[model samples]
Structure formats: C-alpha cells, structure tokens
Target: MTTQMIIRLDSETKTKLTKLAQAEGKNTSQVVRELIEDYIQNRDMGSYIDDLWDRLGKKLKARNVGSREIERAIYESRASKK
Candidate 1:
C-alpha cells in the first residue's frame, strides 16, 4: 500500500533537484526518498559505532608488547641505524 504526501522546496532548489533526478534516470520522489533514507540510517548508526569503538579499544589494550621496555628498545633500535 502507498500514500501520497506533499513537500515544499524553494524554486532554485526544485530546479536543481529536478535536473539531478532526470540525469540519474529517476523521478524526484525516488531521489529524495534515497537521500532521506541514507540520512536517517547514518543518524541512527551513531550509538552502534560508539559501542564497537569501546570493544575495539579494549582488545588493543590487551594485546602483547614484544619487549619488556618498549620505548627504550625503540630508541636503541633507532640509534643503531646508519
């Protein structure tokens, strides 16, 4: 089932949107719907991204460092170079 709704835009915006829709071989509504959908999805995904970042940070902290004194080892390695 489908229902029709009306939207208002300034004339300059409408002209640009119409040309973009035509160039993409889609009607104005289809292009607008896709842009609106992407906007909504990106906004909604922010919380999920924060949770994933926390999980990744924990994993990185847990990973082993090869040498007991990492900074000293790096300075020694660098000094040995020509």
Candidate 2:
C-alpha cells in the first residue's frame, strides 16, 4: 500500500526540481520517492547489515563455500570465545 505525503518547498527550489526531473525523464513524485528511499536505505543499519551479509554470501558461494562449512566455522568461532 502507498500513501501520499505533502511537503513544503520554496517556489524556486520546486521549479528547479521540476526542471531537473523533466530533464531526467521523470516526474517530481518519482524523483522525490527515489530520494526518500535512498535516504532511508542509507540511514537504516538493519538494511545495511542485511545487504552486507548478502554480498558476503554471494562471494563465499562463488568460492565454492557450502552451508556446512559456514556452520562449522561459526561453531568453531563461538567455541573459541568460551
């Protein structure tokens, strides 16, 4: 589900934004939505960590690492901390 958000911007800024948006072949709303999404993604630590793990998993997989190897590594790391 999506909702509408009303924001206040100075007239000059709005004009410039509209022109820029047009040049990029997008509407003001699309540009604003992308900016908001990027801002949230950058500030959201949980999302950052999830992305990090995903990249790590892909890299490990490319090197032929398996789930069992990952589990064993985790087990050894935890055991050493005790």
Candidate 3:
C-alpha cells in the first residue's frame, strides 16, 4: 500500500526538477520516489543489513550451500559462543 505526501517547493526548484525529470524520461514523482528510495537505502541500517544478507544468501546458493549447511553453521557458531 502507498500513501500520498505533500511537499512544498519554490517555483524555481519545481521548474528545474520538472525539466530534469522530463529530460530523464520520467515524471517528477518518479524522480522524487527514486530520491526517497536512495535516501532510505543510504541511511536505513535495517535495509542495509537485509540487502547484505540477501547478497550473502545468493552467494551461498551459487556455491551449492543448502539450508542444512547454514543451520549447522549457525548451531556451531552458537555452541562456540557458549
């Protein structure tokens, strides 16, 4: 689900943004969405960690490492900490 947000910008800024967005073959809203997504991806630690884990999972799968190996590793790691 998506919600609407209202932001206030000066005329000059709005005009420039519109022109740039057009030049990039996108609407102002798309540009704004991209900016917001990038901002969140940069500053959100949870998002960063989730992406990291996703990449790691992909690499492990590529190497044919299955859930059993992952579970064993996790169990071993926890045991080592005790």
Candidate 4:
C-alpha cells in the first residue's frame, strides 16, 4: 500500500536521521514514515476536538446548540463557494 518516496536532506540531517533510526532498530524509511504519519494525523484532527470544545462553549455561554445547529454550522463551513 506504500509507494516509493525520494527525499533530499542536508548531510547533517541525513546523518542524524540514520543514527536515530539505527538506535531505534529501524531504518530511515520506517522512521520517516512513522513521523510523517503521526504529523499528518495530528495536523488533520488536532483542531477537530478543539473545535468541538469551542462549539460546546458557544452552546453553553449563549444556549446549548442542538444537533441541528451543529449540522448547519458544518454545512455552512464546508459548502462549496460555487
């Protein structure tokens, strides 16, 4: 399920990565992949849970929003401009 990826890095960075991988009993590819996956997951969902809290706060301070309110917000936020 994974394809080849070619990356270029500075000599020091490459050496560091290789050393870290060896210390961890992993290869550079595996370490980089794991790091990239974790980074991507956090970047994607890191704001989602925070947004839930923000929305819940809005609901509490003003009035608790029902499911319909959330659905409307979601729709408006993601709807195409065109």
- Highest lDDT scorer: 2
Question: What is the Cα-based lDDT of residue 11 in candidate 4?
Answer: 100
lDDT of 3 at 57: 91
* Full-model lDDT for every candidate: 0.82, 0.99, 0.98, 0.85
Which ranges of candidate 3 are over 4 A from the true structure? 66-82
Clash count, one per candidate:
0, 0, 0, 0
Q: What tens digits encode model 3's per-residue C-alpha lDDT throughout 1-82?
A: 9999999999999999999999999999999999999998999999999999999999999999999999999999999999
lDDT of 1 by residue, 1-82 (tens): 8678799999999999999999999999999889977887778778679878788667756785434556777688999994
Candidate 2 lDDT over residue span 3-72, tens digit each: 9999999999999999999999999999999999999999999999999999999999999999999999
lDDT of the structure predicted as candidate 2: 0.99
lDDT of 4 by residue, 1-82 (tens): 8799899999999999999899999999999899998887778776778878888788765875677877888898889653
Give candidate 4's TM-score: 0.53
| Model 2's TM-score against the true structure | 0.84
Instruction: Give the poorly placed runs of model 2, Cα more than 4 Å off.
Output: 75-82
TM-scores of the candidates in the order shown? 0.50, 0.84, 0.74, 0.53
**Most TM-score-accurate candidate:** 2
By TM-score rank, best first, the candidates go 2, 3, 4, 1
lDDT score at residue 57, model 2, on the 0-100 scale: 92
The residue pairs that clash in candidate 4, if any, are none
Query: Which is the better candidate, 3 or 4, if ranked by TM-score?
Result: 3
